[model samples]
Target: MAAHEMIADDLLAPAASADPHRVLATLREQDPVHWSATHRAWLVTRYDDVAAALGNKALSSDRVRPLLEARKSHDASASDRIRELLSEWMVVTDPPAHTRLRRLAGRAFKQQQISAMGERIERLVDSLLDEFVAGGHTDLIAHVAYPLPATVIAEMLGAPAGDRDRFRHWSDELALVAFGTGGQARPDRHERALRGLEELFDYLRSLVELRRTQPGDDMLSAMMVDDSSGEMLTEDELVGMCALLLFAGHETTTNSIANGVLALLEHPEQLALLRREPETITTAVEELLRFDGPIKVLNRWVVEDFDLRGRSIRSGERVYLVIAAANRDPARFAEPDRPDLSRNPNPHIAFGRGIHACIGAQLARLETRIALAEVVERLPGLRLDDGRPEWKASLASRSLTELTVAHDAAR
Candidate 1:
């Protein structure tokens, strides 16, 4: 490897991007943590190193500055600027602010609170899947990916049932804009995403006022009674948090469900095994997440100088954990590339680990398990229909933009 490396172009274009397993495996085998000028971040491919980075709070998720520097190296582009604007959502915030906001939001996503919504999620998934049967041809992502989490988060936010489609549209734009293609921020797409977020905030702003006057079962009501000082979230924080949950909640799970289904279809033996033993659903879900996780990698900017993998990473430097790669690390699991539900003690960071572990993982697991099981049970001879699937043009959020599948009815 040269001292100054040219980031591979296969990585630049989403469709042309290297198969994540191959890239991760190569990095783990050679450079566990190597700085690539292309991405402008120290990419950590090894499991131990990736975990260490994810667990380090000293490394902030507030990435505006690092992104700024990365932009300087390039001639500048739409995608780069687009990423800069998406720094508002809580997912990008660092503590004590991140801690404060996450704690407040946790009130709404408590295990009991999230669990209580399961039956409704089941109904939502089953009802939509019912449509797939009647239509006989459906893009699982368009039909299911965008809906389940959209409806789930909307219900939690107390958004109007009529606005579900609108919410989905906005959420999709926001998700894409935030995770838009590599190099130079994509301005147009970024604006489009933020515009949707602005609209969502307007809706939530009014809802916040209403909650103040007359609280309801919605999470908005809970956020009003801030744990600290027993005061409600400031109007800005309230809107920011709402934007975060509605957007992040939907974005994270959508990819997992889409990616997980793709994995199941690709691995016929495991899919059949899952159908034979429904009890293995949980393990199967974990395997799918481990096999092809939703949140591929996490970003971090070093706040203080520290030694990482024998390399002298200075303050204000960038470090990224290639989670997708770590999950497939051979040392971490046997036959690392193989998707085996029988693989025990499979602890992978599909939802992430430590402070930022996905709060809604349990819900995501349930949504994925039920939706996948229903597909396997309902869609007969369901297999990848197209010669190749088209991947979303995003390095951060790995997903299929279109997955054509062949299917028949089970008589």
Candidate 2:
């Protein structure tokens, strides 16, 4: 790849080995808004540029429409179920629809409601830790990180406890189809994703029906009745909302916990600082998120012609906001690469910005704070068993395939 060539072309290559930060920093300095021939979208890298683009009105978040349209050309029938599932996702819709969905779901994620789960979360954390603490070695992802949030979200959604593992499997397959790296043209992967979605929808529909006949004190039951304004989610909307919450609820937090722990292990000083002053765990969680958050890239489609970084971006074009790169921009963060537990005034868009920001942000933070606190406190002399941890081959979210660690057997 030549120096002047668009970086997206190389980034999309399966074997591209250049560090992502170096490539993004090069682009941020030379061409912050260069159009990519490979992705057919503009790549936004700088912190300010990415943040601004996230809130730009001209950029739309209605990603499902394009996929549905493309799939209509071949196998239109298959697209129906997928569309029904994705169209109701709050993250992929524009205003009015987005506003309504956010309003309905946002009520359940209020800080007070999330805080109430603290005791429940702590008990869950303790139960999970008990399973692996004695073994002295375990895959944190499977034993703790994945199950903690999966179980929490499952209980909140009133899903059967026995089905948590199956739900996780479906979530994994859908993630590949919905947010996998490379382009959106893989037939085999999409077929698997559609099948997963079908099965998930079937299960959720039954759960919703059960809640209708035999209402329980769960979020699903709470969302069934109308609000004071007499607005209630339709059957399709309810199912879609449940599906989105079930998958997104655990996926990002699972990665966040894994990534946060890895970041601390890599920087022993930061970990030591966190150990000495446990009160800093709150700020430490923020720093961990800033240092190595789960999400890597976010997509927004241009709704109208606009000037960005002195370049004209045409309508119908897509833009990839490299959030991971932006978080490490030196201009915005001093020593952007270093993990400082008490770094004050740290403003990172890890959960995103604007109207479409993650609604479950508070819940995720609470879970991470509790999980990290317990792990660091209970498990002494913890260290990575594998020298080289594996990262998932994904562009949507930065995740570990597995994270095995060992600690003192006495603990």
Candidate 3:
């Protein structure tokens, strides 16, 4: 299909999911600000455009709140709860509110706290790998990628270890809606997503109450208590934030680990370099993030008229800042398509950019760094299984459905 003929679903196609860099590169070069008739959104592809759009004040991140007013009718009220919770998310709000929420939430991700988690994360990786390597062949995602970050975030939130499985289930359900499944209507998926949202909210509300009564040093407790400015998060806000944290915390990291491993395994030279000089894991992780990161497209609504790359973007229109495309933009990085473990000064916005940049980025970086090091150290002979890897049909994020691999058992 012609680049200009690109529709919203084009990005969600299985082929696109498997190799988005190729598809995005075409759009980036041909039409940086291509309009999608089906999605009713402008897809900003180039590195410059995406970087600019992320920090652009003309765009508003309050996409959820707009839906709240538009879908005010009785028929739409059924999903009002979903929209209400989403609107409360710090990610979907503009200044003042976003500023306040981010400030309060930012406390949960202090540098010291993240730094301290290294040993604990190391222990978790070792423990998980113990059980993981027992099987000669296994799905890396299910064994390591999915559980590592999930358990870490769960423990931080004071969630019971037994409830980790439930979190994964709920997260999967939420992904269907959160990532915009192929831009196709699926009532079943929407219902499951709503159920997952409601269930998560209810579960978090109980946790919030418990933290309020018998607070601890956990993140949820930290969020509930007053900050240096004596600002306290409201109960609903706390619940919403916790839900967002749990989902965002594990989901992206899970994808990063899986994608990072897949990238390394594909590029044996890079993998060998990581094995030879383990210190380079940090840069390796950054390169892995840029090569195939979790974030794909971040949504924004144009609240004011703006001209971008010779295209006019009017108010009340949706804009999709294609991070995947931008990260691979040849104009920004030398050899943008290749994966180089030692690539320095990598400014790829895998976690996003500007005020809405990922709050959990440091923690994610820590988790990924530890997780990749352990995998490379332990699974020395690891290699992909015979069949092709499956990529989730998602537009908002890049994720693997599964990554089955086998390693030499003589370790």
Which candidate ranks first by TM-score, i.e. highest?
3
Candidate 3 on 1-411: residue-level lDDT in tens? 774775334776678878887778877887888987756788889998899888999999998766556645633654576786787788888999999999988876672387888999999998888888765448888888888876887788888778877877777666655345332356565567788888988888888888778988788887877787889899889888877887777779998999999999999999999999999998989999999998889989999998987889999999999998999888899999899999998999998989999898989999999999999998868899867798877778788878988887563
Estimate every model's Cα lDDT from 0 to 1. 0.73, 0.81, 0.83
Model 1 C-alpha lDDT per residue in residues 1-411, reported as the tens digit of each score: 563253342344543353666656666777777777777678887887787777786788887545655645543544454444456556777877777777777766672376677678878887887886677656888787768888888778777688788778767666644444222255455456556666777787887888889888888887777575574568878877777777667867877788888888888898889878878878888998888887677778888888876888888877777888888888788898889987778888888877777877877888887777777777768888877676655667676766677788632
1 or 2: which has the higher lDDT? 2
TM-score of each candidate structure, all chains considered together: 0.90, 0.92, 0.93
TM-score of 1: 0.90
- Model 3 local distance difference test score: 0.83
Q: Give stretches of model 1 more than 4 Å off.
A: 1-10, 13-18, 65-88, 181-187, 228-231
Query: Model 3: how far is 308 from its true place, Å?
Result: 1.0
Query: What CA root-mean-square deviation does each model show from the true structure?
Result: 3.3, 2.6, 2.5
Model 1 Cα shift for residue 147 (angstroms): 1.5
Candidate 3 off by > 4 Å: 1-9, 67-75, 181-186
Error of 1 at 288 (Å): 0.5
Worst 10 residues of 3 by lDDT: 176-185
